[model samples]
Target: MTESRPHALFCFGTLLDPRVQTALFGRTVPTEAATLAGHATRPLAVAGDSVTAAGGRDVRPTLARKLGATVEGGVLRLSDRELAAADDHEIDDHVRRRVTLASGETAWAHLDARPLRAAARIVIVGDSIAYGRCDPEGGWAGQFATAHIAADEHAHRVFNLAVPGSTLADVGEQTPALLPPRHPDTIVVAAGINDSAVPLAASDTGIDGLRDITGPLDALLATARRHHARLVVLGPLWLDESCTGDFEGLRFTAARALELRAALRTWCAEHHVDHLDLWEPLRDRPELFVDGLHPGTEGHKELYRYLSAHHC
Candidate 1:
């Protein structure tokens, strides 16, 4: 009798596809669906690509009224060769690494750490696009999570707490609560469009809505610094006034979008946070967008490539 392979594989990304699994692993090993606690899955935007965000805060709405949710996927147990193939396939956007399970056991999982520092805990906060709005498989966050793992084998972990329709103020208010008690190694802030759309009321004080967003971001950064974590702030992508979609008729203008990007860039510089500009690449590629804002699968792929080339 042939002996079974002694490896267990945990998949939380595109490999969850049964066909993808069969294609990679053959019919040699058994596979099952597994969920890890204290971790919720969601889509994340990396550079210009998409990936899953795992082993972080629960962004599902019901969990805490925040953008809390669980990203569902499949787990497989296969031979070393299968794992190697899987690693190669994910190499373009992710890196494989070891993760401790909720049960206190260890297993290999993919991490996306292109712009991430080694052994750093990074947090990404944003709105729908950041939360992966139109992505069918998930979104850029999920894509980044997978690619980060597959690309950088040494990053501690990437946490994503993006909420659909969430404004910068929302992120400022909610993200800190979701973060671990200790400071993170890094924090990526991707908010502005939503905040710009509504435009804070004139009477609002303390920190204008935009600054409200930046305030929390600043706080997170300070906390990260105290904990010795780096800070990365991502500016908004391009916006073509002529294009329209889900967010259409809402009120976002190209000028507004540009202004938002400028503000974010300035903020990052002022705070001394690493900033990544996602506008130039997508500016000419109208086809990349499913609507004016969301990215299609091809768009997501392009985003991954852009991020891999620039950040990773």
Candidate 2:
């Protein structure tokens, strides 16, 4: 067994809330009232009275680095497990940094440093998998972005443009308009499963076979190439055994998935694009998928791990 290390972290945001602390660590650790210099707390809400605040307005507080400013917060000492849990709870918008507290002690703190986007712009376009169905947070997009930030000193923002139940036509229609004016560093296309499997009456009259979708897939790739973006194509994943029986009234068979997968691999090879076979890696892990179709939070974490290792 490995030794557990004692860790210290300064909190000024949601982690400062005792309720959040209890949820993350199971129990609140003893905290010391602390102050951080060279930082200031800013109210995130717009100028509105408490009673007159508009709906959908942000009312949370945020900490910012400012010269000669001081922010009052708490310093928490945590075990290794608690530290890991806290790291997992923080979203991609934050990073841990060393800071000096009012007591003249150094501790780590999560800071909102994602606004400093000094890295590449990554865009993901696809169906439910890219859309992160079932997971509360943004799913694989969030995982990938967060992993990038945590792993590298410099990282990029991941733009998820996937819409659940969308088809090739939907992607063709939305992607051109959704992309930024500037060329992105990387563009991942993970569609085609919906286009090939969805029933004709439900949303789209999906293609009968792989040949039918080649034209559209090529067109999307060609457009991405035109914009000078590095392209990555992800094939569809296998559904759970529970969904072996007719899925979505279209009987989403494994044969159909395999066919689409083959076509995708061929197209990617010809186009000189990176292709990830979602089926191969996830076929054994049925528990990661929820409802025998969509990836759950654990599944999204698995995807993040694979993409981080192979693609990112």
Candidate 3:
């Protein structure tokens, strides 16, 4: 309809999640309660742990025409870009249909012809390293996603939500809003160089003035637990003397990096989370580093190999 919310889309499934909207559309579109008549949602057992239903069950939904039935959901206003994003997000499993809502407005709705299963989802969040920085092919996470987590046809959908220069505290704040009501099968993180450098550069927390990552890490773990996501934290990267002095007025030390990594290892051990250690293997390989902080193209490629071998 060319009325309000010209590109209206009725969401009755995961698209209802604000985090999913942010990840897909880059922003949450305004939504209003709406209903679809003469159609009903039927649940199907989803292969793999892709879709999570209420009460911790698993289900993939199929919207089908059923006389006198109605599906209650919200209508979202999507721009051209957001409409394309939404279509891309559900490209593997859903098809869009122009349907009449209870409000007598014609809108788009996502439906599955077969509605058999959903691709298991993997969500990654972190800093510049995770963002792939200087790497042309995104990063290791991007590589892993492209290579496929499983060899079968039911490959998982991947999303890289990492932001550059993000610290543990910043990540902790963003995690809750990054995940959906139904958690992802896995959550990968790559960060920490920024955090360790922050305190030595500027800050007087009344303690030792050095950054303590344990507290923020714990908080992050707690948030992940609430979502029940399988966490995989990429370990610290080694920096050369280029970083030892000061890059952007922020002093980075090998000692602090080691300390933070050790804490992360210990935390992962106690919490039973996955920690991929790249420090030792990468420390001596100075050529792998780009700006002495982030990894280069080859470095990311090498990291992809490591990730695929270990945890992809």
Candidate 4:
């Protein structure tokens, strides 16, 4: 319905967890313990911790398709907003379907769906570009998460592991450590700017020059492929005025950014990972960048728009 209204929802998974219910629906509603017919339940491999049911057993439950079977759950009357929120909480792995309960009541139940589009662990690693330098809240990662939730209606976590002024080597070293606890299904790498900007002496393998991050880039991609099933690598963004004019010996320029972008595009191709070239789409949009280097709020929005059109 267009207007906010109350709707009945059947939860079979971790939605049975009141902590999860409160996180997704804002507040827990009065739920009636109920049962759905002709379905079984199993464990799902998403990021959420195993839920402890009322009987003191930990489980990660997913609805299994079966004939003449029954599954126990609770039904909650949620508002239109909360219903939408519940849908978003389910993410890509689960789809909402109308089903008849054991009590002969037709209610909406979330069922497991496809793999990638279902509930997943998405991680973003990079430098200031991914970090949302100037406008903290408007970072592309945040925008993607919001849009992803709105579109998927399932809870997928986007962990932003980007650091300002971080080189590809830094990301490589951090990736193995970062992936524990919650391994990523899709990992996006947005780096190369810091590698191109910093001085030669500051880098470990910049023996070739400031932008010579081949060693680190290789290390990072290797780590990504090792820990994740799907990978998306992103290139550096465009800068306004050449940082060379601002800082001596620093060769941060549009040309350099383009060069780095091309190199990254080639690398992603070689690795057979999804690649997004951030330079071309954003190069001409001077207003999107705050200072010549980092993106402003609108810049982040533009980045998100470009990502939505190309990758998301």
Candidate 5:
């Protein structure tokens, strides 16, 4: 008798850790450092606020100074049992779904979406929050990956191409590289937090940073529409006051974050994009923060639950 080929799981977060993988899979599984095409990864950070990480200023404090090189991690492959364990671990916010790998192969993974009769290919584009910043096991995006279900289980896939500190400007330059050749059914825009943090003086043409924001947002929406994808715009979440210490230049109060949220809400309305506001419920809950900007375990779970329930 021949042994069965193990089920493959492409893990990009805490599960990339060998020890963590063992804990979840009951044994160390095969893994690799493969990049998912149409996505780039970067170090997660808190925007609109700050927090202490490694005893340094938390929010973009290393701007003038070189903090270090790039953040790195491995992608894991697991057996069916391990995948099930991962699903259970992430059960609070995600439902397991299928995805297409860079090599044009299909695999099962978690996705964030409400229960729907039709499964739509979802493309999430943004910075760290969409990249699964703070939560080591999985960020809200990861939870969303684990939670979304499709009308036809085999027909849908979700792609997350979020980069930490990725501003709208960066997305404009990188969209062609990050978007799949075939368009997705739905596109989620989770930007602006970084744009709000960038210095107002960076642009060469004397355009304000706000223009920098709108420029890319406009292009991104155009791209989505060209592909016939439904667009969903997500507003920024509130920043924990305690986390504000690290971000030197872009100091914003919770009220300011809410103000940004309101502005984004208006933007989405004008553009006809479906809007989801993340700040409304988290305004008072500092505990939801892992280090003030990033959501803790509970925070990830809550975000997933909220979005899943409200997804149309």
Candidate 6:
């Protein structure tokens, strides 16, 4: 597993209050005084303060992005769970972003989240399956993005953020930066194949990075979860053993696929995340696959049909 990334939070409002901190975090939070650039303090337009301020006063302060403006704040030292708790306390309406403090510490700052309530925004993060590489229609998520927008505009705004040849760890490391300032309503994760890949030169029934699988999946969805996106997970595809050798410098087998798929399925059930299993239905359909790894055009259509019908 990759070394855990240090997460620092910049607080400019009630989050700085010790009472509020304790209420949300269950203890006093240690912090470093800092300043943020391109933002300034402002009166909140919210209906009421989410948390009451010190001394039972109803006073509240908020921050807005402003040019040439700076907000004095402190960076809070927090565990990953603590940071997520802070996000939950903030109502999940703020888009927490990676920022550089004036003192040069990389931290997370809550910024304006222009919530799009009218249109649905979907973000797909995964490897080649999510990328829709072999499909002419650009894959299932691609079909969602372009199906109705060719002439008539569709209310659905789909962001296909999948990268070719990415493992969940690789994608998790990069996904947060790829998120737009505006929060997406839904984030779909289509990963797990590459993690189970074994070299074509050899064969192994064992999956090497089992720890990496679930850990990386959590990391992959962390940002979206903080942003309050509904999640849909597509499990690892079932491999075709008859054509499983010597593709993409990896030897993939039905056994490896089943093993990897089980890992993902169990993790999903444990986490209470919505998981769609493609293993059983597609296990017998080898004709749709160009390689044991990727689906052909018709296969892409099938993938789209299933994902669209089941995505909630």
lDDT of each: 0.60, 0.67, 0.69, 0.67, 0.59, 0.68
* Better TM-score candidate (1, 4): 4
Task: Report how far off residue 192 is in candidate 1 (Å).
Answer: 4.9
Best candidate (score: lDDT) = 3
Residues 48-154, model 1: lDDT tens digits: 22222342332211100011223344467767778787886563445554443444445566654344523235677888777777787666667877766666456
Question: For each candidate, how many residue pairs have backbone atoms clashing (under 3 Å)?
Answer: 39, 0, 0, 11, 15, 0
What is the C-alpha lDDT profile of model 5 across 1-312, one tens digit per residue? 654466655556656666766777777766765433433332334333312333364332110101121222344565556667877754233445444455545454444433221225677888877888777866777777665544335645678888887767887777756665635756778763665553433453353345435677778877765554455777587778677654644544565555567767777767645567887666779988866666777887788777766763
Error of 6 at 110 (Å): 26
- Which stretches of model 1 miss by more than 4 angstroms? 1-114, 117-120, 151-155, 181-183, 198-213, 245-249
Better of 1 and 6 by lDDT: 6
User: Which residue pairs collide in model 6, if any?
Assistant: none
TM-score for all models, in order of appearance: 0.55, 0.56, 0.57, 0.57, 0.57, 0.57
Flag clash pairs in model 3: none
Residue 13, candidate 3: how far off, in angstroms?
33
lDDT per residue (tens digit) for residues 1-312 in model 3 = 553335888988878899889888788777799998766777655544433533377566767544456899999988877888888766344556456788877677776522112224567788888888898888786777676544443534678888988887778788778787434645666754777774443454443423566676677766655543345677688877564565666667788788778878887777655577878657778799877778888988887776655443
Candidate 1, after superposition: displacement of residue 129 in Å? 1.1
Q: Candidate 6: deviation at residue 258, Å?
A: 1.0
Task: Estimate the overall C-alpha local distance difference test score of candidate 1.
Answer: 0.60
Higher-lDDT candidate of 4 and 6 = 6
lDDT tens string, model 2, 1-312? Answer: 876777889886667678778988898777788988756666544343332243345454556544456888888888888988887766544456455666767677765433222125667788887888889877877777676556553434567778887776667667877775634645678763675564636554654545566676777766665543445677688766556566666656667777788878887667545667778667877788777777899888887777666544
Off by over 4 Å in 4: 1-119, 151-154, 198-212, 242-244, 247-249
Scored by Cα lDDT, where does model 6 land? 0.68
